[model samples]
Target: MSKTDFSASQLIEIAKALAASGQNFIWVVKNGEKTEGEDREEWLPEGFEKKMQGNGLIIRGWAPQMLILDHEAVGGFMTHCGWNSALEGITAGVPMVTWPLSAEQFYNEKLITDVLKIGVAVGAQEWSRGERKILVKMEEIEHAITELMVGEEAEGLRNRTRALKEMARRATEVEGSSYCDLNSLLGDLRAMNLPATRTG
Candidate 1:
């Protein structure tokens, strides 16, 4: 449910994918205001939402995404590859289908897909910075979402995501990597007489 922007072609593709997948989804159109016009039907394929009404909940405006991702029913996410959203999905132990919008999100997608092995790339792995944009076909999106949701091929992705979630949780505990690193830094500062080590 990470339709980050209003790409008409991409949206249509996503609509088709959602319709074809037959999985339960909560799609959030982030910038629905862009379609405030008479040609709204043209904006989204006619009868698309109606056909999908049974299994999909298409929200036109804001949504509580963090809470939704945290839910047990949400097994995967359609992500824009934004770092914050990526981290949030990981924290929620949900795997992602990466659809990077622009900028460094492409890199983040790679980290998740290649390095972390916790996600699958939907489309547009190239960088888009107002100069060029890649249109991801509906079939690719459909395949990506299907694989993520219930394709049985996504078990590895889910397992890796859960492992990462545990690692992230452990990193915050008193004896974890993050906690130890913070203490080490503080100890060094204390040795240097830095006031940052003292209680305020």
Candidate 2:
């Protein structure tokens, strides 16, 4: 994953874009402490609060645990390619627009974008060498979000994710592979429960 930073202005821009797109029920999670050295009002763009008041854009400080992502209303995720987030999204059959933020995150992006085909990489910065900053402009962010929200690629990923989720469910059913493995382990345990051989 590559290191990246964003100003409050940028976040506000994103919120505005989401609003302009007529997105309903948009949720954003961020750090609680407001960044210093900027005007408080400017931290959030003018009219943003109004747009969110009844239009469905929700902005909250602090990261969401499991609720928002799991909600059916969540059609897309703008993520910092964490492995756990990737797995959760896949399991929930939610497609994502990945924004890697570290070395391992770059690798995870490969798994998501290249291997699993469940996500799209958005304005990825090279992870090689000492280069630390990979900036993604608001336009790219808007484009990626739009693409992932509604497009052929997004539909394909959604279908694939759903299939994968179903397959995972089947793997844990009573007659499934994991179930059989568990049964086999139980049998071994039962054998161990038998009386020990006297000659042993």
Candidate 3:
């Protein structure tokens, strides 16, 4: 799936909110030439270039896969709740603000919010269709980003994700669950072999 359809005004608003809240954030945008349809200039707000000048906010057209989540500076993810993105966030132990864009994404949001408990779902509801189809206002965006960046709830989710990471590590160790399963499989294979071919 394509990256989010965040406008430049929205990007600026989020950047300003993060800066005001003392959170370091980078606003990533698609390169004009590489993007389809309207140009980036048309979508971008006035003075956006000047606002981004040397503020530690990256306005790159593309980011390497998993690089942003792996970075120490990346504290949280503002995401569309795609399964791949969710897995990347979980593997990296980064908390997320789920802004799902479709029905499938809503399901993904439930996985992150209800099942995994590793991320916050923006505008999520227990019984209603969420704000997936709606365009999020600047205030809502700012609030969600801020909450995911520093809220105690987000921190709790981060801690749980870290614990899960440790558990996975232990499960794959030399004397771990998977190792024991492999050993048992090997023993069963040996037992199935008929008396080492009697002739030899």
Candidate 4:
């Protein structure tokens, strides 16, 4: 879940979907003082923690997201499609269930689901910055998770993500495209500052 404001109802729905998915998961539910008048008891589906027991772990507040993504047991990611989160998912080679919220998140979602073909959409439509509630129902969320985590389609997504992971890794190496480009840029800048070459 995003650090951005999400309605209590939205939280409840997401919890229900994760429970219904029947796959083991770790959910980070941001911990803070309850919203103005909100009840913590109503934040999740009834008996959610108890029901999830051994199958799921819900961490209140911060969890080590990059570490979790790097674990081999992690099959997929349910994300808000923020740029940093998207990049983490790519580097970890995990496909995603994209639920865009605001800013450039929707664009990130499209890049993940459409251009990259390494994610599935949870059907979150409108953009919001907490001014309005954006709800993606349990069924839609579960379907997207299933799409990203099960069968042949899921394997294909994983393969593509792994390929991207390799590419990203290579881009950081000294001989890689990004490394070469940066060095080239530095050379250009250095040349430009070399106290203008003497003219004949």
Candidate 5:
């Protein structure tokens, strides 16, 4: 969830696929943040909300992401593969449909799908920067979502992600990696007790 980076047509396809798949989804669109006079009303396909009213919801601007992802109803994430969101999804034990946008996102996708074995890629293999954005076809989005959510492969992905969730939780414990690193940094700072005049 940082962003789906979907094009207009792709958004329509996502709507179609979500409806057809009969899965629950919450799509976050920053419509309120749109520039002056932008066509926010047309953001989704016509009748999209009513069509998928029972199965989906479009959050116009913001959402409590951590709460949503940690909810029992949430099964998978369609993510931009940003490290923070990726880790959050993992901590929540939610598998993902990776649609990387730019910077280290492509690399993060590899970690999610390859190294971590927790997600499936959405066929967006290149960076789309500047004024141009990568146009991920509807077919790819649909296929990726379907495969990760209901396909036979989904079971394993779900199990692996749950395992990752435990590991992430443990990492914050008293002697875990994150805790150890934090303590080490604190110790180094305390050791650096230079002259009070200079330190202050």
Candidate 6:
């Protein structure tokens, strides 16, 4: 996440799209450090909270991302395409609506969309960098979410993600790829130490 923050105007745009999606969601808005007495309403479309009261949960700051993604009720994730966030979503077997903001996120989006085929991109062409340029609009966002959450494409995405999730789980188990690789590295180091001790 690395202290990334979207501008208030962008947040409003996202709110509008989420409202248009008509899907249940939990949005975590990370607006970096808040100013003293900052008005939170400025970040949302008018009556947005009220309209989403029963259907959505909007967290103003940090939230338990893994817990949310691991929940069975969570069908899709709207992510910034950060590496950790992408991996978390994948491990949770959740398909994503990717909105890459900056850095390697755009590349991560490519992996999720082009390589993994488990995510839909929100059509962000450039980094907003907390400014008021409309890189992605509400309609694009709504479309991405809808694509990731509905239809046969969505089902295929979920199945692939679930398979990846199982592979990730296996990698960390005893005698699995990750475990074996770590043990091999340790064995090499220990062998090096044996020669050093004999020479000493």
Measured against the true structure, the TM-scores of the candidates, in listed sequence, are 0.82, 0.73, 0.68, 0.90, 0.88, 0.87
Candidate 2: C-alpha lDDT: 0.69
Worst 10 residues of 4 by lDDT: 32-41
Q: How far out, in Å, is residue 110 in model 4?
A: 1.4
Model 6 regions more than 4 Å off: 31-38, 128-132, 192-200
Which parts of model 4 are misplaced by more than 4 Å? 191-200
Indicate whether candidate 1 or candidate 6 has the larger lDDT.
6
lDDT of 6 at 29: 70
Say which candidate scores most in TM-score: 4
Kindly list the per-residue Cα lDDT of model 2 for residues 6-89, writing each as its tens digit: 556655666666666565655654534444465434566676777578766555555454577778877777677887777778
Candidate 3 ranges beyond 4 A from true positions: 1-22, 33-37, 52-56, 124-133, 170-200
- lDDT tens digits, residue span 107-193, model 6: 999999999999999888887566536647888988999898885698999999999999999998999999999999999988887
TM accuracy, model 6:
0.87
lDDT of 1 by residue, 7-54 (tens): 566668778888887788888766435542333346678887787777
**lDDT of all the models against the reference?**
0.80, 0.69, 0.67, 0.87, 0.81, 0.84
Of the pair 5 and 6, which is ahead by lDDT? 6
Report clash pairs, candidate 3.
none
lDDT of 5 by residue, 11-36 (tens): 66667777767778898876544322
Off by over 4 Å in 5: 1-6, 33-38, 194-200
Ranking by TM-score: 4, 5, 6, 1, 2, 3
TM-score of 4: 0.90
Superpose all Cα atoms of candidate 3 onto the true structure and report the RMSD in Å to 1 decimal. Answer: 7.2
